[model samples]
Target: MNDEEQYSVWPHGTPVPAGWRSTGFSGDETTCLAHIDEVWTDLRPRGLREWLATRS
Candidate 1:
């Protein structure tokens, strides 16, 4: 994930993008996606979530 808290699947053994880091979970595409679905319940980005928190 990046500063935005978004999740994506990167090919194993490939270098991750500059702003993104591994969640330390590596697996096949389906498994990765399922893991993301389970953990990333909040779809909002970090900035948006912080802003909403301030409003609340």
Candidate 2:
């Protein structure tokens, strides 16, 4: 997730698509979800950042 909080997921062994990079983690469904659960604690979108910045 960039400064934007947008993210993408591809199946195991799939090539990384253009404009995307690996987060250096991989696993099966349960493992992947566990990783996401641990890492993606913030669900807010990039728009929220922009909005908050304007408010400041």
Best by TM-score: 1
lDDT of 2 by residue, 1-56 (tens): 44466566679788877657788777787887788788887678778968988998
List clashing residue pairs in candidate 2.
Answer: none
Give model 1's TM-score versus the native structure: 0.95
Clashing residue pair totals per candidate (backbone < 3 A): 0, 0
Model 2: lDDT of residue 50: 82
Name the best candidate (by lDDT): 1
lDDT of 2: 0.75
lDDT of 1 by residue, 17-55 (tens): 999999999999999999999999999999999999999
TM-score of each: 0.95, 0.64
